[model samples]
Target: MRFLPSVQFIEQSRVADEFVAPAAVLANRLLDAKGLGGLPPCSVSYFIEELHRPGAAIGLHSKGRANVRLNLAWLAKLAQQETAPEWEVAFVILHEYAHFVLELLEAREVSPGATRRRIEAGHADFLRRMSHLGWLADPVSRKLLSNHNAIAEEWYCDAFAYWVAGTLPEPHAEFFYELLAGVRFPPTS
Candidate 1:
């Protein structure tokens, strides 16, 4: 389903309109790409909040609920960076949307919740794939990979976002392409 702004989001538009509107536009593009590839229909609700952390955005979806929270402070900080590219904000938004897509696919499964083994296996597969790209050895990437529970989803989102952003490296990009292409949601009428 197309991303739908939450009622609260619309009510608070005056406070976040400048950023939220643009992010929504980019989100639509990312969602369209996923839809064309067969991801499930799921509505996204977003809000600007004091995430109070460095993360610019976070996406959550499960059992039919999906939402994205954007950290205004972090986003402003990133925008101030001299090296920040024009597409940085859009990429951040798209990354979060990727999380929603993956979670929706998991939720739509016949048996619903994935087993711990399944999740761990997915994490292991991610590590192996990153290792091939020579990213696993990087200290920062290594630390993130070490916490499979906390950071595994980020890895998936990053792969999907980077792939769509046209920045994911070689075979890794192909990995996300096939991974997403495998989602088999019933066609929405």
Candidate 2:
């Protein structure tokens, strides 16, 4: 049940080659641990390139296309560092992979729309409860939590990453736990 996507390095680099295989292995192991070994092999492609995003690094999962793009420069840089950001890199890859998995799970549903509505409602309720606890009083926090679908998707991805790694890197670790404490994603049937 090991799933290895077609990995392509847009730019020729020893660093990219060195990391892709191990990253894929980590991803597969995580998936297997999560009982997702039942998923049929998919034609997902992993493209390593400079994402051109204005952040330290980023990864993207093209919706419905099964294409995951990881920041090549970032991977290379992380590898060259004294303290390799193994957890960070894993998080990026797993988060994007979660998006692909979530889409696949939704596609398997008899009623995808109903599934989405349930997710949105559940997430909205969570936000409301958190707000009542004065946890989301900050304007920035409120604005970010305003979009149920977006926040839910991000939270699900984060949860998947946490589930895979069994932990999350700092700054995110505490928030992620609090955000997903009682949420059941895709809402179990």
Candidate 3:
């Protein structure tokens, strides 16, 4: 598959080329299907292990560097599974791409401060409701909601993934629903 000019796949993992190649192709297809085939140049690197974080993270986006890091170990495992692992992997890629897009939007001031503020407010309100419902009691949820901006950014990213993919993978549906309850995408213009 021909990848978008904006995205380059960087292989820095011990996983077999057979596994990495398919994942990269799937990622490209996912982005292209979502109409995100014209983004600015950025690298998507596959790493040998999960990123150092509080929870089980399969992917991460580095805003300062404008790049994405995926866990090759995780992808390899998924590739071996008989079920539809591609869907989950697609979600992860799109989630990170959402972060990249968010950073670009903010850096270019595409919608100025209004978009960020709306996302923050929407996510803050979602958190408040979740807190009242005791959903924040879970350690993973707590860690994910460490701060206002962090949670807001996460909400937007997850929402973008869902929006682009049409559905969250079954395993992540509940968690994503909780994070994105009432958070609508801000107007692009």
Candidate 4:
């Protein structure tokens, strides 16, 4: 439950006024959040640049256990005009931390079907849409199905986010549940 090197983006100028302190506090708290003790040591990489496009992923969990990066560029923008900007930053960070923990706990060979079922149950609304799509156009669905390795990880990560911030204000949970409902990565056909 130790933090790695600090996540400093020298180019940061926007969220400097608001986000960084809370981000650091939340990251340190998460390292020992009890439920997330099994999670890997995730170091945040704050960047001053924009993501590939508009509304891209604000934070990403990658390279298994080493890195979890968050973009300060967007955060700064939100900070300038938004009330309680740090709370939003904290929420998204916990989401990425969820991804980190899932990667730490993942078995190398979890079957795609079993993994999908587990995730679907956890995210019940997606389960219904997926099941409906599975039934209505079985052939097309079979044709369209692709391995869900990364997506399954994302689902578990989403649940972890839910668990991590279960005590946060209601908007975070509502937004998270909405995100969870349409959670498929490649988009269901």
lDDT of 1 by residue, 149-173 (tens): 3566666666566666566655555
- How accurate locally, in lDDT, is each candidate? 0.55, 0.53, 0.54, 0.47
lDDT of 1 at 40: 37
Model 4 per-residue lDDT tens digits across residues 1-189: 121222332244433534556765775465455334444565656555544442233445566565545555555455445365555666566666665444433444255454446555545544444566665543322322334312655545544544454543333345344433322123212
- Pairs clashing within candidate 4: none
Query: Which candidate leads the pack in lDDT?
Result: 1
Report clash pairs, candidate 1.
Answer: 1-41, 1-42
Those runs of model 2 whose alpha carbons end farther than 4 Å from true positions after fitting are 1-11, 41-51, 54-65, 129-150, 168-189
Runs off by more than 4 Å, candidate 4: 1-10, 13-18, 48-54, 58-64, 108-113, 125-156, 168-189
Ten residues in sequence with the least summed lDDT for candidate 4: 1-10
Global CA lDDT computed for model 1: 0.55
Give stretches of model 3 more than 4 Å off.
1-16, 50-66, 110-113, 124-150, 168-189
- Number of backbone collisions per candidate, in order? 2, 0, 0, 0
RMSD of each: 7.3, 8.7, 9.2, 12.0
Candidate 3's TM-score: 0.55
- Say which prediction, candidate 1 or candidate 3, comes out ahead on TM-score: 1
How much is 54 displaced in model 4, in angstroms? Answer: 4.7
- 1-189 in candidate 3: lDDT tens per residue? 222111122242334344445655776665555445555434566555534431233344454444566665565556446674555665666667767676655665545785578668766765675577585354433433555336677776765666555453333345444333333233233
